[model samples]
Target: MGRKVEEVVEVLVEPIANRNGLELVDIEYSKEGQDWILRVFIDKKEGVSLDDCQSVSRELSDILDKKDPIDKTYLLEVSSPGIDRPLKKDEDFIRFSGRKVDISTYAPINGEKKLNGELLGIDEGNIKLVVDGEELNIPREKVSQARLAVEF
Candidate 1:
């Protein structure tokens, strides 16, 4: 059910994001406590502004109202993915190469399930990372989640 909602919202939101000169990074539909939240993460080269989120929210709100895709009540949230953004697509892996990243695998790789290192990018169905001066090539399918690691 959640996956279906995400798919439906993605189809409805992509055009609006493109028209607004924004990249649709990800869409999430999940229950938090008693409420369902529909989160839309967007990005742009110049970075996303509050106005961008507001505009997308307004337009998307109207579209969702008319389309009425979801059967239950959910709060819609439109915002930037932020510095520690998720790395979802292959393009994201290439685009964020050389950046620090945190990755979790569905199963242990080298006896570790969580890895934090410099992203060496994706190559030939693998996600390459350099951890402690050692390069590790993790099969893309094994990665459960990957995101930029916040550095302070």
Candidate 2:
């Protein structure tokens, strides 16, 4: 049910984002307490602003209201992915190379399941990382999740 809502929202909002010179980073639909929240993450080369979020929210809200995609009432939130934005696509790896990232694999890599380091990008279907001053190659398929890591 939730997945369908996400899919519908994605299909509806992606064109709107592109038309506005924005990238639709992700969509999430979930229930928290008694509320269903639909979150849309957007991005641009120059980053997103409050006005950008409001614009997207307004435009998408109109479309959603017209299409009536979801049967349940949900709160719609549009925002930037922030500094710790997720790295989900191959292009994301290339675009964000040299940034710090947290990666987790389905199974142990070099006896470790989690690694935090600089993103070295993709190489021959492997994710390259520089952890603790040592380079490591992790197969892309082995990665279960990955996101930018804040180093402070």
Candidate 3:
């Protein structure tokens, strides 16, 4: 059910995002208190604004009402992914080159699963990360999840 909801949301939101010049970073439908909460994360080169969120919310809400993909009542939230945006695709790795990132792998590579360092970017066939004075080329297939690490 959850998976279906995600798929449907993507199908519905992609056009809206494209029309508004925003990237649909992620979507979540989860329980909070007694209600199900739906959140859609958006981003752009200049960052998203409250007006963007409100516009998306209004338009998407109307579509959701008409389509009724989700039968249950839920509160909808449309917002930005913020500074710690997820690195979901290979393109993200290329786009965030030279940025600091934290990544986890499906299994240990060189005896570790978690790696935090500067991302040099995606090369022809690998993800290059500089860790501990050494650069490790982690193949994209091995990465489980990655996100920009907020450096304080």
Candidate 4:
């Protein structure tokens, strides 16, 4: 059900983002406590502003109201993917190469499930990383989540 909602929202929102000169980073449909929340994450090369979020939210809200894709009520949220933004698509991996990242695998890789390192980018269906001067090649399918690592 959650996956279906995300798909529907993605379809509905992608065009709006593109029209607004923003990249649709990700769409999340999940239950938090007693409420279901639909989160839309957007980005742009110049970075996203509050105006960008508000405009996208207003447009999406109207469309969702008319489409009525979800059966139950849910809170709609539109925002920027912050400093530690998620790396969702293959393009993201390539684009963020050389940046610090945190990646989690569905199963252990080299006896570790969580890895934090410099992203060397994707190569041959694998995510390459440099950890402690050692390089590791993790199969892309094994990665459960990958996101930029916040460095202070």
Q: Write one digit per residue (lDDT tens) for candidate 1, span 45-112.
A: 99999999999999999999998999999999999999999999999999999999999999999899
Worst 10 residues of 4 by lDDT: 123-132
For model 3, residues 1-152, the per-residue Cα lDDT tens digits are 77779889989998999999999998889888998989999999998999999999999999999999998999999999989899887788889999999999998978999999999998876889999879999988999889999999
lDDT for model 2, on a 0 to 1 scale?
A: 0.93
Listed in order, each prediction's TM-score against the native is 0.97, 0.91, 0.90, 0.97
Lowest-sum lDDT 10-residue window in model 2 = 82-91
The candidate that wins on lDDT is 1
Candidate 3 to truth, TM: 0.90
Better of 2 and 4 by TM-score: 4
Note the Cα lDDT for every prediction shown: 0.97, 0.93, 0.91, 0.96
* Candidate 4 lDDT by residue in tens digits, 45-145: 99999999999999999999999999998999999999999998989999999999999999999899999999999988899999889999999999999
TM-score of 1: 0.97
lDDT sort, best first: 1, 4, 2, 3
Tell me which residue pairs clash in candidate 4.
none
Where is model 2 more than 4 Å wrong at Cα?
none
Candidate 1: lDDT over CA atoms?
A: 0.97
RMSD of each: 0.8, 1.5, 1.7, 0.8
How accurate locally is residue 151 in candidate 1, as Cα lDDT from 0 to 100?
A: 99
